[model samples]
Target: MLRRLVLTAAASVAALSAAPVAAHADTAADLGARAGDRLTVTVTDAGEGQDGTFDLECRPTGGSHPDPAGACATLDQVPWGKDPFAPVAPDAMCTMQYGGPATAHITGTWHGRHVDASFKRTDGCEISRWDSLVPVLPTTAGA
Candidate 1:
């Protein structure tokens, strides 16, 4: 009986471990609403000097712009020597993180694509906010 119970428990654990994890992605409407919102997101880590650019573009979807009123916020010229693992709060304008004495947090958003950037602070791991974007071209209300 003990052997059977142990085998059952082991089988259950194995089944659970073999289960596939589900992942979710954001949509265009969500991204449009986030326009102009401030976020602190990690761009990329090239393992060199901190230098990168975040480009925001609006590609017509379904024969029209997605968000016509909001302009996609452009965040370029990001330079960093090391990763900033901190939870930088997001706003409706820019991606601004607090002072060096920063705290860590895991925060990300779901827009068309899940664009989340995280860091590793000495205290803990951190996540940047989703940058706001002001759509240069917006979609028509009817179209």
Candidate 2:
């Protein structure tokens, strides 16, 4: 009886430790893209624990509409201190940018984890609104 008890206890401990691994469950795979006058990105944590280092990208959808390079150039030079288009914090979980027809990628750190997401720009000049919610996984070791 004592031996059985010990074995049961050990088994319980092992199961508890592994529980966390399996606890990371997601019901569905969420992937979407949008673009309009406003560039917006929403990241949902889909891991056992809170995630971190989320990065989002805004890429011109349907293959660079016009000059992809120029669009990016405009975004890069756009002053964050100006109206509407401003530089975001180096560590913002959610972020938005203003520019032309181009996708925006935003990334940040949360709960000691790193995540990445992207969006495609298509319409608007302040009227274009790209909205999407991406799944964020836990940052693995050395990520």
Give the winner by TM-score.
2
After superposing candidate 1 on the true structure, give the runs of residues whose Cα lies further than 4 Å from its correct spot: 19-62, 69-143
Regions more than 4 Å wrong, model 2? 9-100, 123-143
Candidate that scores best on lDDT: 2
RMSD of each: 15.6, 17.3
TM-score between candidate 1 and the true structure:
0.19
* Number of clashes found in candidate 1: 30
Angstrom error of the Cα, residue 8, model 2: value is 2.5
Name the TM-score of candidate 2.
0.23
TM-scores of the candidates are 0.19, 0.23
Candidate 2: tens digits of C-alpha lDDT, residues 34-101: 22112223322323332323223334422212233443344435455332232333464443443333
List model 1 lDDT by residue over 1-143, tens digit each. 99999999999998777654321223445556444333332223322332233333333221122332243222222233322222444533432433132221222332323434443322211212222221221111211
